[model samples]
Target: MSRYEEAKLNYEKMGVDVEGALTLCAATPISIHCWQGDDVRGFDQKDGRAGDGIQTTGDYPGRAGSFEELKADFLKAASLIPGKKRINLHASYAVFPEGEWADRDKTAYRYFIPWVEFAREHGFGIDFNPTCFSHPMVKNGLTLSSPDEAVRRFWIDHCIACRQVAQRMGEALGDKVLNNIWVPDGMKDVPADRMGPRLRLKAALDEIFAENCPNVIDSVESKVFGIGLESYTVGSGEFFMAYASQHPGVYHLLDNGHYHPTELVSDKIPTLLCYFDVLPLHVTRPVRWDSDHVVLFDDELREMMTEIVRCGGLQKVLIGLDFFDASINRVAAWVVGTRNAQKALLWALLQPHEALKALQDSADFTEKMVRMEEAKTLPFGDIWREYCRREGVSADESWFEDVKAYEREVLSRRGT
Candidate 1:
């Protein structure tokens, strides 16, 4: 018998439906971040620099130099990946006509109409984030919770404008646009008055989320800390979780890299599933600190996906990728990270969850351990290859050749 046929038979014997896993995984959409190609250097800035708390390491050559270049690179990377996909865009990536410009607060939907056109043509959903960092107005490392009313108002207006832009994008694309808000408002050292900033932040969020937009899914993201902002983060997990819990139609987003080093998002998924009807995730790899590393088919990723599938919230949760690594080939990074995420999900889906649950519930720990150990050695590679073949993407490392060719033919020509 053929290898795939043998693998399929083996999986069936274990009560795992191989075909079902492939079908479900193919329909799962992962939101790919746009900032990866340019190392978080958005098109809005001519200086090509991020904010105080924001930093992109390494000087990788052939970074996308323009909106057109970024789109082209994204398309190439997307082509190599399998299953359903969506584009996650930051407001800083907004494009404008020649000789025209708009600051963060003054940004209009017109600047992002090209993104909508792109999404429509490509048959991809779009998600958005308000660019809260990399701006001059974020004085003293505070925004949305700034003591300066002018600074706070600027960011508030910016977020409000971003929501409108997202609303228009969703209307244009015929899908709800997840508009996530993550502000870099924190202090370099311990702060004397945390309550004042948090109170102000709560008020700012109240104002930003005051109006309801039909096409936008609002999400608030919290960070434990950032590069320069180490001691205190104004938007802590407790604050946003409480706020999102109280507010209707707003969701609290969890970034895998946005928490303390020891905490795992895999464990938190089940907790959030209990309270939230719908959850949004920012899947990323955190090395030591919250360093945005390229994701791999690692243990944490597998555990995270396993939890999502086990909870039967596969469709209820929104999955979006968030990371930028300039140390390697940008297109290759995109393909590897996204494909690894899909692989993790597919692996989780292929598990015999019902049998495992039964074993655990009946206190058959020995049998459960044996079954789990055997599952690790199953013909998952064959199933994964079959999946890639069915999806019409390269089933192996051959796809890297295409990325290399593109680098030589297109990326290498960009001036030094």
Candidate 2:
């Protein structure tokens, strides 16, 4: 038998439904980072210029040139993925020097306009990260945790401006633009004297939500670290549940990599779903040291998928492959990482509900493990190939190649 056939046999041994797997696969929205390459700038440790001594407040990478060029580059990178056009704008563009946070009005408007136009012209949506680490306001972190009143004001104003811009852009494009807000506003030290800033930040968010910007959905991102501040108020899951619940339009956005090392991945999704409400997901693998590494699939990932299926909220889950500058080509990095994520989702869907029901109803941990072990494993690429072969969809060697070809065709017609 052929290698494809052999792989199929292995998948079948897992006892998963092939058709159900593909259906979940196709429903899954393949997303990537908007700032697709070395263009991402912020947090001097990662991609910023060396020896600046300044930790934050670096220049924006994508804004090095004209706005038109940046817009075109974004389109070029996005065109590579088939049936997957949604993107998450890097926080750097909205906060770095020459970015939206730098200007109160014009620059912010100019910065988001191109993306809005791009979305309108291409029929795609854009996700925004409310400035996390660039501006002086965030030097110590933002929202419910900033010590300085002036710095807290700065952060709050930036968020207000983003809501306004998102509203305008939505009117311009006729679609919702997601406002993703994650704060490095947690404390590593003692938790005293943190309540004042926390209350202030909460009040600020309440004011922003009262504005009722129809174009924006505030998705609050949670993290475990406090940057310059001695401590943070909103780091853990319980904190997010309490804080986000008070707000009208905001929802908790769970980053897969942000959980504690000892935390159970399966328990997280269902627990969050049961309590704080399910929002969009920021998908990425976390290392033992809590570094955000974009790597391949592992056996542990199955737990996350199992929980996702168990919750029966697949539609609420939005896929984001949150990778940093570890790869040579950003597009290739996203496609490969996303492919693995999709495979995991597909495998989870193939699992019979009966198996999950058993686990959910069981009191014994060993019984649950046995049920989990009985679920089948599906080779993602092989399944894709099989589906394509059955449906007569031609297989491309690489997603990047497909992207380049499309770019050439589009630019050629534009006479670039």
Candidate 3:
């Protein structure tokens, strides 16, 4: 018998539908972030440097410098990845007409029409984020919660405008656009009056979320701390969780990288599934700190996906990639991280969740442990190869060789 046939029989013995896992894996939509290609340097800036806490290292030779180059590079990256992929955009990536520009507050649907058209062409969904960092409007490392009314007002207006743009993008594509808001509003030193800033932020959120856009899914993201703003994070996880619990429509987003080092987002996923009808996730690998590093098919990632599947969050969770590492080939970075995420998800889907749960519920711990360990010996690599073959992408390291050829042919000549 063929290897895949043998693997399928083994999984079927465990009550796992191998074909169903492959179908769901391919049909699942994962949002791919755009900032990775150019190292988070959006086209909106003159120097194209994302100076705010969104930092990236390495002097990669072929960083995309313009909107056209970025689009081309993104297309190249997308081609290397399989399954239903979507583009996640920060408002800072808004494209204006040649010789004309609009500040964040004044950004309109016109500024993002190209992106909408691009989505239509690729048959991909689009998600949005109000880029709250890398701007001059920030006052003393704060935006929505800034003490300066002008600074707060500017950011609030910008977020409102982004929602409008997000609504329009969703309308254009006939799919809801995820409008997630992540503000780098914190302090380098502990603020004396914490209540004041969070209160102001709550009020600002009230204002930004006042006029509901039917097609926009609003989300709020909290960070433990950033590079310069380490002492205190204004929008703490507790604050956003409480706010989300209070507000019916606003969802609290959880970035795997945006938490304390010891905390496991895998554990939190099931905890959140118990309450929230819908969950949004930002998948990134954090080494020690919340540093946005390329994702791999590692233990934590597998555990995270396992929780999502076990908790029946496949339909409810919105998955999006948020890592950027200019230290390697940027397009290759996209391929590796995104494929790893899909691989992890597929791995989770291949497990026999029902049988395992039954074993746990009946106090059959010994059998559950034996079954779990035995699964490790199954023909999983064959199944994974079969998945890649069906998806029309290379299953082996041959994919990287394709990336290398593209780099030598296209990326190497850029900015020359």
Task: List per-prediction Cα lDDT, in the order shown.
Answer: 0.92, 0.58, 0.90
lDDT-best of 1 and 2: 1
* lDDT of candidate 2 over 1-416, digit per residue (tens): 86567766765565656666666666566556654343344332223431111122223222323345445555555543334456677444543334224433222655666566666677776776655454434543454356677666666776777777777766777767777766667555676675665576567677656788888877777665433443444545666667777765688887766666777656667766775444677776777633456546676566677678758767665656666533344444555565566556666766666654666677666866775665443455676666545533333555567645644554334421
- The number of the candidate with the highest lDDT is 1
Candidate 3 at residue 128, lDDT?
97
Question: How much lDDT does candidate 1 score?
Answer: 0.92
**Per-residue CA lDDT of candidate 3, range 1-416, in tens?**
99999999999998999999999999999999999989888877776676666788888788887788889889988887878999999898888887899889887999888888998998989999998888888778889998899999999999999999999998899999999999888888878998999999999999999997999998999889998989988899999999998998899899999999999899999998888998999999999888889999998999999999889888889999999888889989999999999999999999988999999999999999999998867788899999998988988888889889888998899982
Q: Name the regions of candidate 3 deviating beyond 4 angstroms.
A: none
Stretches of candidate 1 off by over 4 Å are none
lDDT at position 135, candidate 3: 84
Order by TM-score, highest first: 1, 3, 2
Using lDDT as the measure, what is the rank order of every candidate, best first? 1, 3, 2
**Residue 164, candidate 3: how far off, in angstroms?**
0.6
For each candidate, what TM-score against the reference?
Answer: 0.99, 0.75, 0.98
Worst 10 residues of 2 by lDDT: 50-59
